[model samples]
Target: MDEYVQLLADLTEAGALGEEWRGAFERAPRSAFIPDTVWAPDDDAPTGYERVTKADAPDAWWSLVNTDGVVVTQVDDGRADGPGIATSSASMPSLVATMLRHLDVRDGHKVLDVGTGTGWTSALLCGRLGDDRVTTVEVDPAIAAEAALRLAAAGFAPERVVGDGLAGWSCAAPYDRIHSTAAVRRVPSAWIEQTRPGGIIVTPWGTPYANAGLLHLMVGRPGEPSHGRFVANVSFMWMRAQRPHAVVEPVGVSDHRGPSAMDPELALEDVNAAFAIGLRVPGVRYEHVWDDADPSGTYRMQLSDGAGSWASVRHTAWDAEDAVHQSGARRLWDEITSARLWWLEEGKPDLHRFGVTIALDGAQSVWLDDSGNPVA
Candidate 1:
């Protein structure tokens, strides 16, 4: 069997791929959607990826494409000589399958696919639900055009629009389901307005502190709240409008310094802890930077509220109490420690146990176990 087939087999064995969607996935092989020239990770480059064209490295390119890993299709939104940060990509096949499974699509159901990167997802939707039922919206014109061509070439043509996915496509309103490939900090009210009551809206949702967890919200009637729990851990590029600021070195003098009893690992390494802490500490972004200059292994876990507030906790290999420093308006370290305590007091629930409710006015609240018990 070929690599693509092997990937499907692997996903099936891993329970990521459901038998109901197997045919759709088979029709939409990832290799067919991946571009000839894509980006691969490079340590030396300032941008995470260096370009790799199929012409120059066919074997490597094919290997990368057929694997279950993500294929970066565009960089810096396809700007000329722009930074190499990935702006669009064909997500991991396993993740794609998992999202589809969570979507719970049925016969005659209509789907609005957001962030049509390579159009692989649109193709799969079209194959399963028919071309007339799938409408995909993409923000980048060039990326959308390329995806259109690929979708046509693959013999699947869904209605494709080049526009911000946050607004969604209102012309085809009251969809049965809406799925997003990108991550969002907030669930747009338009999505709720466009989806029929009892419809499912699956997307990667998170705060600035965490790029994401896969959310599967069940839409309520118009003017009512939509609620859902996080089903899985996922990391996707933020929606262009919701993208957080890049981590930069903290400026200004330290406002306060003291010893911190909390371990930096909870914030940096524990995904569940980070997700819960993020709900408590909104607008916070963090970076764990290693001190390569030091002979002894040490790192600084820094947190910034993206306003004037910032904090840093220096950690050594010996597990000694770290020194915490805070500057500007908010004592971010103190807030995080308190949030961590809250998380621990609540039994440190996993991400799956967390849910969110979006009111009609677009106000969002995170909760544990149920929507009635909002996270404080």
Candidate 2:
């Protein structure tokens, strides 16, 4: 009657835990892989979390672990003093199960698991196919060591490679399947190179403009470009190298000007619109901002990129005449609004309707209906 046991039962009833993956789920219960100290979302805060550890708060830690939400294990490469950027985490069970189901691996298939976070996925692979058929790679040396020790303690041992996952473990090339636990802005050609023809690759696809989803690609011949359709809408932290490296000089918000005819309210409600916008616009980052000056607590969609471009669309309500201001070389808000409008005109394709084709140059072209025409 332990809470974790009850959680397994609940996940099973809900169909999140497949029969094939159940044994792995039971044997490697996420609780075993997670660290004693973890960070969980703070209910009272908008974008903050409270740390819970077995030493100081065992009850809270257990409660949060079994509650089915992401647990931040390391923040800011383990250097941040407080709840900062979550560099590593024990992903929720449902999400893990979703990815595994999409992976569609079978017995005797050699799987290369990218992003050895907590080693839970590797352990699951071990439980199903045995340790011999699984190979895992971690980008962070410290994380690799910790995960290796955890996997060993859990009575599973897979080929552990301490190297950049983006390059892939070429030593074990021609893997029957590949699964990446990280969000990638660009599909790495090395991954396609390493995967065998007819093999499947499952990874999270991220856009710089603030949207992400699951990309399930079925590999063709070695020289053929890897292509696949997005299967789900989900968010993940960016891959290490894909993160912002260069610093952009600061900008005063007062410099931008103009009232936009485009309705800000229309942009905020459509998740599909946001995804389409990100597809058309590259390297753009956006956030929902609020100022106390507005009594209505209206949120402004703020957009910017490394090109010194910035735009903000504020509205007290969606149908109201919202104010928009833009500055710099690129007009981000105009690009986003135009993209959103185009999506509407095209009948609004969902995630599944969209697919990506990775050229030999490693450039990814996202298209709708088919790969004939790339999205703007």
Candidate 3:
């Protein structure tokens, strides 16, 4: 515990935490609000966690709370106790600080915080702007109850509402700053209507193919809507109401098999390829599969869309050629290859160089280099 406190202090000393936010983070220590039991995030783990509880492993729990990693609070939307899927968590300190930095908060400003989570963020805001100046909207009633209790216990009493975060807490309209913890596919109109002109809305935004990137909108006055470019690439869980429908494995119908066109290596090597494809391939989600245990010595990439379009490409380490198969109206592999080639033509711009604009009519346009040239 002593070491963790010094670690937090070190981050502030190193300028990772803003001067204005350092004191706030110190005042509302993350440890105070964390639950006794948390599922440690493990991407490689099939279940996604190895539970660490205070009562069972006090040292480990303390170490995790004080360290710089996520502490999962809920699994499968409050079900599947053994971590079938992590639904909610206390984000790593660095991510919290990064998003807060993007917020660029100031004193005496009214802030609306979406997705209360553990209420630690609200407590930090309360320490900076006073409790009356911060309002947090939470969707889960039980989580809200516990978080509100902890917030009050920590001597911070911010307005805590148990409602949909997408609604933007209408009672607190015209806020000076709006921050969303959840990732969004598009900027909600309520968030726009509730924020005053020139206000900042910071959130991680992603697409159906890939869930990564931050959307920083410096809203303009009425008749002008909001527009901004991504400042970083981040993968965050989707906002609950905005989550996409599940994509299942496609059953081969014999005719679904076909010949290969492009090398699977070409599409897989570039990291930002997924982000570039998401902008071009609407309503499509792709999954990559690697089986170390398979005796066939093969790996695969599968693509699917809501309209029953599906495709697969298989590669064998011992073989020279990769096999490709398509079954539906859309040649999913072809779409991926085309998108990758276009991205290359555009100089393979980084995700940060890409931008998005929400026009007055609610139409969203993605661009590269200049907002005038829409990508899709």
Off by over 4 Å in 3: 41-46, 81-83, 252-256, 265-271, 290-296, 317-322
Once fitted onto the true fold, the runs of candidate 1 whose alpha carbons sit more than 4 angstroms away are 80-83, 290-292, 295-298, 317-322
lDDT of 3: 0.82
What does candidate 3's lDDT look like per residue over 19-108, in tens digits? 778888888999989988888766687886777899999988888888888888878887755438777788888788888888888777
lDDT of each: 0.88, 0.82, 0.82
Count backbone clashes in candidate 3.
Answer: 0
lDDT of 1 by residue, 1-376 (tens): 2988989999999999988989998888888888999999998988878788999999989988989898888888888588777888989989999999999999999999999999999999998999999999999888899999999999998999999999999999879999999999999989989999999999999999876699999998766788999999999999999998765656657568778867777665588888888999889888878767873465788888778888888776324444787888889988988998999899989999999998878888889998878988
Cα lDDT for residue 136, model 3? Answer: 97
Of 1 and 3, the candidate ahead on TM-score is 1
Between which residue pairs do clashes occur in model 1?
Answer: none
Please provide TM-scores, in order, for all candidate models, with all chains considered together. Answer: 0.94, 0.91, 0.92
* lDDT value, candidate 2, whole model: 0.82
Root-mean-square deviation per candidate: 2.0, 2.7, 2.4
**Candidate 2 per-residue C-alpha lDDT over 298-347 given as tens digits, one digit per residue, 9 for 90 to 100:** 56777778778877777654434447677788888788778788888988
